[model samples]
Target: MAAVVHRLAGPALLAHRDGIRAVYAAAFAEPPWHAEPAEADGYLTRLAGDVQRPGFAGAVALDGERVLGFATAWTSSTPLPGTRSYPRVTAALGAERAAAWLCGGTEVDELAVSPAAHGRGLGRTLLEAVTRDAPDARCWLLTSVRADATVRFYERLGWRQVTHPAPDGYGTAVFLGPGHPARAAAVLPSL
Candidate 1:
């Protein structure tokens, strides 16, 4: 069955928390994420609160009633809360650039596709559906460098890697969305 991507927000997204958790568990259990079921449960608990944030949005790729994949995003602000990576991203991009580029911009918090859904273009469809109407079309996301396929996937979709100051923990790699103002400035000058 061909999967169809649907944009979701507000109560609609909250209503699919179970489906989202199911997809996340199946997707992240693979090599890169290795997330436990408890972790998915914890994420759903956090997502319950995240939906209340301003500009929260999500997209799901569904084959009929079954979720094939999903993506979620929200607007970011200075001193981004809840994760050490935010500080590292700020430090890497600097206060001025980070503010100009990321603050108030959309941040892709999660994008996951079930292993069974791989190579079906559902990931790309969900990604575009979730961020298509982002503020100023600016969006960003972080992923582990170890996830070569994941990194390549984003890069293939025109995302630019920010190559300055290395992230401190977990080898996180940050990417600027296509057409972002900071993308051109964030590239390290060749020696």
Candidate 2:
């Protein structure tokens, strides 16, 4: 069956809160330091409210009404704006730095496609949906060091690693948006 991707408004997200959380929990059985923490049932309900705010966006890839993959993003009001910050944003990015980094751009708060749906480009498709919808916004995300495959996947899509596993920050790697300044030397044609 063909996958149908739908952009979910805030209220709609609340309506499918459980499904959204499922994606996060499954994807982040052990996500990176900077990446948000896995969601609990309660967190799922909280997210429904958060994603409804201005500058927020989310999408779900469905195959005949079943969620196969999902993505969500949000706008920031600080210096280094991002979509949404989760897990422990302050600890992951350094308290002061976290707020600075998430001030304006559209952040890929969460992106997950089940293993069963891998290789079908759902991750990329969901990403494209947010980016396309927010042409004026910069995009970014935090991913784990262990997620080697996922890292390579983002790189192929024009994202650049801003943070590394080092003393100053969580072992997490921060990926900048498409064509971001840091990505100047890392551009590869999108597939």
lDDT tens readout by residue for model 2, 13-117: 566666666666666655442325444465676675777666888788889867788888877555443323343454555656555444566777678887678
Error of 2 at 32 (Å): 6.3
Worst 10 residues of 1 by lDDT: 163-172
**lDDT per residue, candidate 1, 1-191, as tens digits?**
78899898757876777888898888788777788988889888888887787888888888988888888888896656646587787777777877888888899989998888899999898889878877777899888887889989998999987844357655787888886767777765466
RMSD of 1: 1.8
lDDT, model 1, position 62:
82
Every model: Cα RMSD to truth: 1.8, 5.5
User: Whose TM-score is greatest here?
Assistant: 1
Which residue pairs overlap in candidate 1's backbone?
Answer: none
